[model samples]
Target: MSQANPDRPDLDLSSCDKEPIRFPGSIQPHGFLLALSPTLQVLQASDNLDDMIGADAARAIGQSLQAVIGEQAGLQLVPEIDAADIGQRPLYLCTLGIGPARHFDVLAHYYDALLILEFESVARASAADFRHLHRQVGDFLLKLTDTASTRTMSALAAQEIRRVTGFGRVMVYQFDDEGHGHVLAECRADDYPSYLGQRFPASDIPRQARELYMLNRIRLIQDADYTPARLVPALNPVTGKPNDLSFAALRSVSPIHLQYMRNMGTLASMSVSLMVKGKLWGLISCHHATPCTVAFDKRTACEQLGQILSMCIESREDANELQFRLDVRRIMVSMLAGLTQSADFIDNLSSVFPALLKFARAGGAAILFEERLLTYGDTPDEEAIRELVAWLDLHCHGDVFHTDQLAALYPPAAALAANSAGLLAMPVSRIHKHYLLWFRPEVVRTVEWAGNPHDKDGAPPAAQLTPRTSFATWRETITGTSAPWHGGEIELAIEFRSALLGIALERAEQMAELAEELGRANKELEAFSYSVSHDLRAPLRHIVGFSDLLLEPSANENLEKRQRFLRNIKDSARLAGKLVDDLLSFSQMGRAALRPTLIQMDDLVRSCIDKLALDIGARQVEWDIGTLPAMRADPTFVQLALYNLLSNAVKFTSQKERAVITIRASDEGAEWVMSIADNGAGFHMDYVHKLFGVFQRLHRMEDFQGTGIGLANVRRIIERHGGRVWAKGAPGNGATFYFSIPKELNI
Candidate 1:
């Protein structure tokens, strides 16, 4: 390492991610660093302090900081330290002059209760330079605010940083969720070799270095080939360990990084971290073909640029996400329409939400929700799916479970490798064992890399840590795994899951409400059934007696009376059977699930008329049917409702010489209102509410031989469809029965 760091000995060296780059014990040689106690007492100093401070670092240690630096410089340190917030990054305190020409910019920060001071040599600069920098930063910020997207902002940032730092090349690149870096925008000299469009493996930065970048915000390497300075007292006296130079601007970098820089032909470089929501979003990396150093004030301006860019980046990302969600909703509507228009959409989606499979880009999808395993498209057998779901339920501890190589995680999945090589499962309900899963088939493809893909693990190539010098394309054949899932796909999956969960919860609430209403209705039905039984039991007994007598020869002595008795028995039995059948159908309607579909009311009404041909046969029924708009509803139940209403019209209008039954439908804003008006035995408007009551006949049984259950069933069916039923009538005039179905209903 360029710096001597007693890095955690317990780190697993096999992986480059475990490197402790943040704990470097020494500082860069171009500058000197001093570690002091909180009270301004010196605890450690760099070995290079001899030429810089005119004293050996070993002797300088254990002495008061006031005696080490001049009393004037010492006095400035106390007040700056007192007014300073130790929690912040390194703060540039003031400039100190050892002589007429020797001056250094002193930066101070607290690390582990120790005051760390970095002394960077200051170059002479005119006042014009400072004003020009301030103007540039101000202009850049204005442009940044006016910028519309991250891409534009990145290009702007790269150009501005290059202009300010005078670097040969500046590149603004971002990291993907997978940690691979891609150069987004670049500003470089003409002679500089283009590194644009280059992709860097995650191992290039390592894990700890990225973390340090987040904590430190900025890092500078004055000379990549410079020697590192050793610390006088290797270990901190206060903590009894190597001083943590995490916040030190002059902290030495790793030898591996220095070598990597040399390999890139970059003599001097500086990087400013672009952070968004505490994450290292990207970097504004500057490189110089020849050795060069930026003034402390100029570097500070670059840091400010990065800070502003982070906020701008977040804003752009948020806007993009909102637009994406809107797009998804629009696409969902289109896909739903296309599916419904298909000849067999319901048949295809008899299992799960198959439409979302388009977003997953998978072979098939499944749902392990509510203990139901439903599969669609190309998928494994039910037994294989159940085992996979069981394994996920037992082992997965997150909101999602994903793997490209399912066989590696679950051995049993290998047998189902044809279509289930990859699986991405997300929970539909956080409180329950409900999950939505997607599948992918095993894919064989070639993976292209800038270097050896095997060395992408961040481990050293050999005994010594070194970077790959080869820029040649490397390709390898990959097998037994599905294409890797991307961030956008996962986000889409989450959105789909959220919408599914919301719909399920809404349906559950509707069901609960319906169940409660059914309970109350059943109770009323029970009481009504008892009353019907009491009224009909006498006729039932008489019918049985009459049938028995007819079979006897003595009872058939009077043939006319025997035929009359038989007629009475037949009428009573017919009424009883009709009542029983109606009651059973009414009871089952509330329990069965609705399989709704897009229904054309016009076709349905015509179909109902065809079925009622027997009832309307040889009758003088003038039917004036009007146009009906298409709607979505349960066809079976709706058909039953239409039949009952039409039958009632036919029965009531039988008295009219030319019975006129007018059937018309009209759009009523929120619902579609259809009226069945007839010039028949119209009742008073005061008794309209009683029309839908079961067995509540307004007319005598002799006048209209009906059970009065038809209208009640119609009311039930309409209400279940999120609609209403009503009637308008006058005594001896005409009655117009109106029933409405909502134009658009989630049900």
Candidate 2:
């Protein structure tokens, strides 16, 4: 392979003066370079140029340009030179099959009556520099998995390009919601002024410019000040004026663009388009002060780097989507566990996931099935979940399917357009049973996505896309521009979804089994309670009567002995009576149908406190009442719970010189928090574990009254409403009892 000298200064095409060429004459270098004709005698040839055509520069000198480029190359040059400066003209310089697909610009001038031609191959670019650029870009893409934010990714891309290309400045420019662009990332040279965060008028790069960017993807205007080629009119009869060949065909250079670059103190400009799914997402713009020409190889590497960058951005976006969906699923599972209706689950997820993930704007999400489509969030208007379900039902067999494959099934308007990259459908199952669909309205900022850690193939491609118009055709020559997503990542996602669906299905089955067992247990408990109340109670009553009879003849016996016997009978009867009552209450709490109503907790607490008015009035007590939120709960159970908590507090605090009880309430987003605190003789911390257990007490009966079931009863009541109750305190530092109620209980 032939190589150009690395030490050679980059060709300063900026000062190429425009002059009319007299092609049929003397040895004029500039004129020869300007000639559109490929057939001309060569006056001089550099060794590099000679080797490019597999010939020595000495022998190639004085030969016709066509002899070097071949007749086919001469024929392809016709349309390229005749291109008008319009939008419709093909900006591409068509390459013909000369000995090989070699591209070159021909310029000629006559001076001294010896016709001469200058040749500059379009493919000759900074190859080594581009390879370095490709490596840097690869490194940057690898770094994208480290952070999820667009700001960081964009910054990294810009900085890496600046470092590799030695650009004076580099910036990542992204369009806003309104298509107005701003510099999202900037890496400036130390000696150069900063253009970071500087806003440019939208008009500077208008809609047309953006469209051009999407089409071109990369651009390099080496030096803007070259002679403009005359616009050649279209030869064929057409409906409109020949498309502005300026956009299509290569002109020497635009003075306006050159002046603009010079004004920015930039001698060379290079920009690579950051794209997603064929659409322009953003740009990596590099600027250099000195006239610099990027060799062809280097440009190819840069294009490969650009492709890798695009993949990184896309992967990051996918990760964010996964996270958002995960969060929504988590919230929905919580909501559904409470048996909240599916509609309520949807609303709760909408408010939770986007808020946490900052997914700027999401339209809707849904799960699709053959029988029904479970739609939620902001559902799209055109393609309903039902349509997706139908499509999947028809096409699904045991592999993932995208909506694009079902285009025929959907109506013209209903069909998701290819341009709406936001429309996504992923199979929840390989068996075609279900799918997940989501819609997002805006471009997603980059996210940190875990990359495939598997080893990749290292064989690199030959050519790549670049920011120069002359190199556009080179893309077709590249074998692989980017490494595709690894099989592992896609498989991992599939496994994740499978696991999620499996867990959901298993949990539903478990719930069904538990419901059946609970029904049976309730019936048996009810039957046992009835037996104890009627059959067992009658026997205890008879025993007590017989014991009384034994102690009946009070007048005929020793009075002390008779009194002892009578006390024994009375104690036994009372013990039996208490056992029966406890059993009945426990059973009742289980069997009674829950009658949830909107009950203000404050009023309930007050009602419980009313029953203890006489006791409170007798003691020097300070009571602090707090406003409590209303909740959906059984009024009777809530009353019992409050009575138990307050009673325990009052009993413990009764020993203090001045008792202080504070009741406070607050809402904790998803739940209501109520705390009851007291300044009293707090129990030992070691005894806290037994506080809410049945028949467990921290203090003796004489100090806190009988029946160690008070706190336990409170716990049971609170738990029945899917809430939690706990106590916190130090010995003698007073104690606070806290409980939370699920907000969805109101429904």
lDDT of 2 by residue, 403-469 (tens): 3222334453133332222434556432234565544333223221111111112222231111111
Writing each residue's lDDT as its tens digit, candidate 1 over 1-747 gives: 222323333434454576556666678877788888867888889988877877689888888887888687788666877887765478777677755566778788877768888888767522213456678778987886544678788889999999888999998888877787777788999988665666666777888899899888888998988877888787778888777788888988876777778877888999999998779988888999678888778888899889988888976775565466446656555544453333332332342355657667789888665566777888998888887777886667454678899999999888877898898998654334566788999998764454664663356556334555554456678677898886556655554444444344334435645675767765765757765675457557877988788778875466457657767775665555455546545654555567789999888888877766777789888889988888888887888888889888888877778888899999889989999999988998778878898777788878888876788889988998999999988766778899999978756
Candidate 1 lDDT for residue 307: 90
In terms of TM-score, the best-performing candidate is: 1
TM, every model: 0.57, 0.33
